[model samples]
Target: MRVGDVFLKVDADQARIEVEAMALAPVPTPKVLWRKPPVLAIAAVPGTALGRLGEPSTASPAAWAAAGAAIRKLHDAPLPPWPGRGLDELAADLDGECEWLVTNGVLPADLVTRNRQVAEAALRPWTPVFTHGTDVDLDVIRAWSSLRSLLGVRWLVEHGFDPTAPGCEVDVLRSRM
Candidate 1:
């Protein structure tokens, strides 16, 4: 929620993480105005959002490249004190979500199966970094994208987003298949 120039973020654990991450991140992040338990007030940063999930990005190629470079810098930063999700945990969650998607007919069985197979490549050992959960491998990246789309479909629908929109998650999965 926005209050004047400050945005108030609610959520205790996430707020804490955001505070720490902002401090550690090499890229520019919103300046923390203040913090009070579940409430974190941050000064608004400059620039508009890149785009929505299902929409075409209006950002220039140079902007995208700059974003990529910033991500690279973040990944190169020292790992945070907290541990990220383990491979076994991530794999289990992916499998469960895929099963749910297929069994509930949210996505095609074949598409889910194929995405599951592709996601297997990402279920390997890797060095930890200060990232918001992304990997370097192209296949692994695609796999995560598929999994995120699958997992997000229900929430998106609940929030009145059309997952079946032309450039949306469903289209992304179909294109991969």
Candidate 2:
């Protein structure tokens, strides 16, 4: 693949992690061309990102379906070797942050506790899949959601994707389980 002229300066360790994550993704990702201590060269994907957060998507419905298909493929692939972080650990981290917020009076204790209770849906056991991390994952999900919302569940049903079913693009590793 042709490496794009664009160069990104990032921490060496983070660049390594990004490269590794891209390699493990079942969906199309930029190809890593080379690495220097603080700059990583990678080929550009054929298309721009499906959309950015809070922006209207100009991509066609076909593009959305293609993305959903790709995400399904990625989610269905074998789990990555890294423990990453368990749901319990993630929940604990949230709890710790909430405690800090409450103690600092940034948020009321009742608000923090309520949010924690609501977050229980995310605290179940799950098999970890390859991810670039929370921010990257959130962006992907935001793009996906924008596309899906534009087309709506009826479109998914008509297109043979199970909007309500487990393991569909909407499920995306069951983060809400």
Candidate 3:
């Protein structure tokens, strides 16, 4: 991976060495203003495995329901140093960001009302789950939502609903569901 011409060459010799990459640059001299902070590129994977069901087979309804149950079980499976402090701090940080969003005219002024609700929601703490890897297991909610949305997409394409248009298969699928 190359970031601004700094090529990252990974090989077996260096596999056990470096764990992270930091950009080499001169630090800014108190230059921050009303601009939003940068978000690092998370080449992101789908939060959950539920979306990997590439196709819906010609199986009974019970089969699909069973798959959903299995996915829930997979997510519930436990794994270690549950970072309590980090989670709380992160939630508070997100609340502050929402405030900044409002302050910087990020969106319509009237939307501040909704943003406040979201801010409150963001400030709420969550129970952390144990899983592999050291980094925070963030985005628990968003992951589930993404998975559920994928399932909906799967259903739509299964019987054939032109998600972009009209189709009899889609109508039949919706009616039966």
Candidate 4:
């Protein structure tokens, strides 16, 4: 995806998964313009990112709360059709990665084993939700804010107005659930 002078490369399969997941999301997402295997075109939604790792947020408190609310809506939605892993599966994957790292000499065997033991202790059950498996950073927060802004965008669609308008568009999405 191109944002001004920067071109962001997305994995084809990952992008496809994200698009499919977004279809069921309660929050707003970038409009998919076209998809051609490795290349997917999407309309850029308005609004800057929430904040950088070490930077202060310029967005209002309400925007932050709205983002949280949006997250709650998503969490409350139905789980995807895929079966999530159990704790044992997670432990096996971790052990496998640690073994690979040690075999490749990426890390000392003792260190990997120690970390793996510690990590295994923390393994437990977790509720699965639709996630991009990426850290929630500035860009993520911005996207959430943009989604909050677009929640009511269905009204614009119903009124025959350009729903993508950055200005002069008021959306009011009323969730049935």
- Best by the TM-score measure: 1
Q: In model 1, which range of ten residues has the least summed lDDT? A: 8-17
Candidate 3, RMSD to the unseen true structure: 16.5
Ranked by lDDT, the better of candidates 2 and 3 is 2
Kindly give the stretch of ten consecutive residues in candidate 2 with the minimal lDDT sum.
Answer: 144-153
TM-score between candidate 2 and the true structure: 0.45
lDDT for model 3 = 0.34
Pick the lDDT winner. 1
lDDT of 1: 0.71
Clashes of each: 0, 0, 0, 3
TM-score of 1: 0.64
Question: Please, what is the TM-score per model?
Answer: 0.64, 0.45, 0.33, 0.46
Regions of candidate 1 where Cα sits further than 4 Å from its true position: 1-23, 30-65, 132-136, 158-160
- After superposition on all CA atoms, what RMSD does each candidate show versus the true structure? 5.9, 13.9, 16.5, 15.5
lDDT of 3 by residue, 92-157 (tens): 544554455456654334443443343343345655442222343444333332222222333334
Query: What lDDT does candidate 4 reach at residue 170?
Result: 24
* Model 2: per-residue Cα lDDT over 116-137, one tens digit each: 5545544555435653232344
Positional deviation of 111 in candidate 4, in angstroms? 9.3
Looking at model 3, report the run of 10 residues with the lowest lDDT sum. Answer: 21-30
lDDT of 4 by residue, 14-94 (tens): 323355767878788778776655445677667776754335789888888777777777767776676654667555655
